[model samples]
Target: MSTRSHSAVMLRRNFKHVARNPTSVFNAVLMPIVMMVMFVYMLGDAFSVGVDYVDYATPGLMLMAVCYGLGAVATAVNSDLTKGIINRFKVMDVSRGAVLTGHVVASVLTNLIAIAALVAVAFLLGFSPSAGLFDWLGVVGLVVLLGLAAGWFTVALGLAAKSPETAGLASVPLVMLPFFSSAIVPAEKMGPGLREFAEYQPFTPVIETLRGLLAGAPSAGDAIAAVAWCVGIALVGYLWARAKFSKRA
Candidate 1:
């Protein structure tokens, strides 16, 4: 079958799967909302860094949305593996890209809803984007790319996991990287050595880049760092996931 035809079929099948499981939808939207509310209210005072903490936090909340979106890839992959659905796909004449396109596209769309909800919540709490429409589009584009790269890594994790619990536990590190970087606080607040490390951490640059875009500031260094991290993660994740998928197949 043609790749497009295959992708359409797979997309339909996956959408059906999601539709049948309404609880997954609830969790996808609920989990991110909970995190956004929890951190913006509880941790805002503890990590005051000279800005409206919510404004500073909007990017971080967006990142969390991306992270949660990526988890859908992991969860779907895990569900397929647990039920031998992947092996069934292997027996079909489906194009390889079909599986990926369906899962990733559905995931991105679902997450966009959560993103809109989160943005609305942020606005309700006094967070406003200083960025113009084009710049805001750029932010969304960058976020989708970042989420795509991260999604592959999570796919690999789900493929390699021994159980659903292991897959769930594995997401912790993925979500924590942003918190440890300059996402919440200014990196300067850390010890000198830690500050330096935070400056160099992958998420720090991405967060900084997004911050500049959202704040209506143009920052070349931040843009370069964000692109670098996205590309690097995509390369590593593709390599790892390809290797694991080959072995599993």
Candidate 2:
């Protein structure tokens, strides 16, 4: 079979697993909803500073959801690795790259769905964006790119981990990164040291770009930086994961 066919088959397997066991999807959807509510109601007034906190926070929450969802990808890949599914595939006639590609594609799809659900909830909670058609397209593209970068990185982490538990734990940092970024608050509001770190981190530029696009004030510089970060991460992660998988096989 062609590599594309092998990937499609593996993709269906991953989707079936998601259908059968949906705890990961539930967590991905729930985390953002809970965070959005807490941020908007508990700290909205203080953080609003004239603009609606929901509006200010929705982009961050969306990005956070995508990042958090990477845990599921890590866990799934780790499970397959530790359980010898990858080894079994190696013995069969299949494209080696398709195994990782399948997981990455499924993960991107899952994150997109999670993002859609989060956006729906945000709209219900009075999070309105002034963006037009082109801007919305840009938002979609940004989300997919971010998902690909994060998902691929998690795949590398999963393969590198000695156990599934370690893989899940390894992804904790990805989930926590938004807290230190402009996701929850403006970097300028942070102190000197933290502000510098937050401003330069990968998540910040992505969040800032998303905020700009959704708010109808696109930041060309931030958007470019965010794309560059995603591309760099995806390339590194793919190469790392491919090397690790080959070594294991």
Candidate 3:
């Protein structure tokens, strides 16, 4: 079979698998909503910086939605690995890039849905953006890119994990970083030591960049730093995942 044909076949198969699984779709949207409510209500008042707590939080929550979608990708990949699907595909005329891309696309699509729902909730909770349509699109684009970058790492984690449960359990740090970073609270409010650390963390740049974009303000150098971090993580993760996939196959 041609390489394009093989890729198309793999993507179709994966999409069908996801579509048939109601639980997967439900959790993708549900988890982000729960987290947003918990943070906005419980921590909103206590977590003030200069910005509106929820507005500052919306970007972080959006990132967290991406993070969770990637974690689900980890679960799906590990499940496939455990079920011998990877080996089955390896023996066939399969394109590894297609296989990876298919999963990544599914992950990005899922994150987009979750983000939309989260944004709706944010809007109902008095969250408003000064951003224009283009700016809104840019924020969406950034979230999608964030999902893709994080998906690479989760894919690697999936390949490395002993089981699906283990893969899910291993993603705690990715979920936790935004809370400590400038996502929920201002860097200045954190301890001087932690504040310094959060200032330079990967997610901080991402959050800051998106925050500025959504606020209709100019972004600082952090935007470049965010792109660098995402691209760097994606490259490293893809290399590691490919190596691991080769070994497992």
Candidate 4:
């Protein structure tokens, strides 16, 4: 079978696994909504971002949804590795790209679903965006780009982890990075030492670009930086994952 065909087969198998075990889905989907409610209700009034707390926070939450969803990708890939699923596929002549592609695409799809659900809840919470058709398209494109990049990175983490449990733990940084970002409040609101860090961290530009798109006035500089970060991470992740898979399988 062609790589595409092999990838499709792997994709189906991965989805089946997800269907049987929905823990990751809850982590990726429900956890963000919980956080959203917590932020917009329990904690929103404490901040003074220029816009509605919901509106300001929605973009950040969307980015968090992507970051938070990566644990599943790592865990799923680790499960396959430790269970000798990849070794079995190796004997059957399955391509490495096919295996990882299945995880990456599936991760991206699940994250999109989570984002959609989050957006729905955001609307219900009085989150209103100035984005138009093009703006929405930009949002999707950027989210997918980030998802693809982070998916591969987490897949590499899974490959590198000692076990499935460790793989879940390995993804903690991705989950935590957004909190330190402009997600909950404006970066300027943070104290001086932390503010500088928040301004330059990878997630910041991406979140800012996303916020800009939703507001119908995205910054070109931020978009450039965001794309550059995504591309660099994806390349590093693909190469690292390929090397690890080659050695193991």
Scored by lDDT, the top model is 4
Residue 163's lDDT in candidate 3? 92
Per-candidate TM-score against the hidden true structure = 0.88, 0.96, 0.90, 0.97
Ranking by lDDT: 4, 2, 3, 1
lDDT string, candidate 3, 1-249, tens digits: 776677677667766676677776666777888888888867689764776777878988888787765566788888888898877887875777777777777777778888999999999877988998887877877787788788888888888999999988777688777777887777888898899989988899998888888898838687788888999988888898888877775
Runs in model 2 lying further than 4 Å from the true structure: none
> Where is model 2 poorest over a 10-residue stretch in terms of lDDT?
41-50
> Of the pair 2 and 4, which is ahead by TM-score?
4
Question: Which is the better candidate, 1 or 4, if ranked by TM-score?
Answer: 4
lDDT of 4 by residue, 1-249 (tens): 999999999989887776567687788889899989999988989888878999999999999999887877898899899999999998999987999999998888888999999999999999999999999999999999999999999999999998999999999998999999888888998999899999999999999999999999999999999999999999999999999998876
Better of 2 and 3 by TM-score: 2
What is the clash tally of candidate 4? 0
How does candidate 3 score on lDDT? 0.80
**Count of steric clashes across candidates, in order:** 0, 0, 0, 0
TM-score comparison, 1 vs 2, better candidate: 2
Candidates sorted by TM-score, best first: 4, 2, 3, 1
